[model samples]
Target: MATKKTSSKEAHHATLDGEDEDATHALELLAGKIGEPPRSSLQAILAGTTDADLVSVGKTILSSRIVTDAARIYRKAWDFYQEASDEQRKRLRGFSKPLLAVAVQQALALEQLDRKLAAKSTSAGVARAAHEKAAEAAQSRAIELRDQAYDALRDAAGRDEGLRAQVDAAFGTATTSETLARGLEQTAKLLRAWLGSDDEALTARLGLANLDDSYAKELATAAKDVRNAAANATNRPADGKVTQGALDRADGINVLIMGQILRAFEGAHGIDPTIPRLVPISTRRLFNRKTKKKAGEIQPPQNGNGPQPTGDGETLSDG
Candidate 1:
């Protein structure tokens, strides 16, 4: 008969069983505190890691869990610690540093990375909407100012017979020129010509109408913004999936914590059956929804400006 294979995970726990039970029990009693940690430490941690860092050292291990999975695993471990009595907490202090702290740091980093990626994914849409809104408002304002200038021209025509010829020459005798009277481009051209005209009367009429090149400039800016937004949207680098770099970092973090846990139990004895496998390896099994895969995926945000999670929102700092 072929001998049964003992998986690395099974072997790991089996090794844990050989460690000093008192140390394992002490570490198990109190968990790390929950909530967002300070930002400086987090920035250093985030910048300190990369995809290249998750290399295996001869021993193979599986670490495919997503960012949220890591966060929740830390949360669960912290939840267990939160239940400890003052005495149990004091017992935990005996160890120079509780092993779980290593896991918690990565949990926080993953939460931050998740948010950054989620924001990046939809940034293009947000910019497009903002630019479009500005363009719409600018066109409306330009048209309003154009109508005001037309009224100024009409009133000036009634007052000055000499100006009437210029008006007819520029616009028309009875009605304004359709080419010069319609659209944003037309309004801008009319404003520029009248504002910059060498004719003293034309310049005076513009002053009387309170029309200036400022409105034309605003329209120009809005038009440029729309074009820029469109280009940026096309070039944006996000696809609503966890970035490969982020996934690799997740693997690195898990491996770090797992090594710490394994070392913490080395040479000790007796199985503490209560120790959770800590986290799943890339499976969405953390929630135990078990109904179907992909159920945990989050819907895209309704608003362009605010950020939402890439995955399940059950964890607020969800990855």
Candidate 2:
């Protein structure tokens, strides 16, 4: 059977659709094995995971600070394994660098995906606020420049109806950005022409010689900010609405390696009991206790369960 071929653009968007049922199904499977932590041990993860759904587990493991702190855990953990001593390597039996590598890649993918989701919610709003602020500033600048020039003209053109008429035409009390911008341009042109006149006494009297350089540049930059920011207010990532299913699936994939990460430290207790701290954000602390090494031979756990999770550490509790 000949299958219809898709164009490159179609293929690209197909990848973006984020409705991969098979990948999401795997997340559903991974979410099931997040064994309940004891009442006094790693109880934090359990609270967030009471529902034990895919997105919930993903959200449980990842707090609000994914872009900066939570996301760095993956690469840092990978580095720990990269420099693992021979004994440390042996400790993490059944766990290979390839597996951690795969986990890190998945972690990176999920991190970027989450960031895109977050930006979609806030970008338009942020740009709108910024545009308003820039426009307000520009309006103020226009008002200031126009008023300063107007007052100069008003005082000089006292009893001179011609120049006073020009000032009236060039300056207005309206405060909108568009109104202010148009009035500012007219006021600047009149001031420049007045300053260039043969009347040195008038130019010096109004002190309008440098209006072209200082006033125009400052007002122009402010006006430009308003224009550019207005564009951003409209053009910001238009498709900010990410699907709930996509978010849930992303969250699932994010924490998919939780059980395997735990299994990696099954015998890694002796190597660094202080670390390989599971997930940097996890409340589950593994191999943090001081274990005994009998006669240089790594002693097994007293209960023989091996490398029990400890209570105290610098682990993240969402605290």
Q: Which one is best on TM-score? A: 2
Alpha-carbon local distance difference test for all models: 0.42, 0.48
**Model 2 lDDT-worst window of ten:** 1-10
Candidate 1 residues 1-319, lDDT tens each?
A: 1121222222222233323233233333333333334556434443544334442110122221333344444455566556755644444321113345645555444444444444554565687676666645544554464455456665644576765555445442212222223333444465677677687876786777666778667545544444444454445454646563554345445544543332222211113333333433343322223333322222233565322212232322112
Q: Please, what is the TM-score per model?
A: 0.35, 0.39
Model 1: lDDT to the true structure: 0.42
In model 2, which residue pairs have backbone atoms overlapping below 3 Å? none
Worst 10 residues of 1 by lDDT: 55-64
| Poorly placed runs, candidate 1 (over 4 Å) | 1-68, 71-99, 116-131, 143-252, 255-319
Candidate 1 residue-wise lDDT at 225: 45
Tens digit of per-residue lDDT, candidate 2, span 62-174? 32222222234444555677687877777776466555544544544554565566555456567678877765665565566667767767776656688789889988655
Best by lDDT: 2
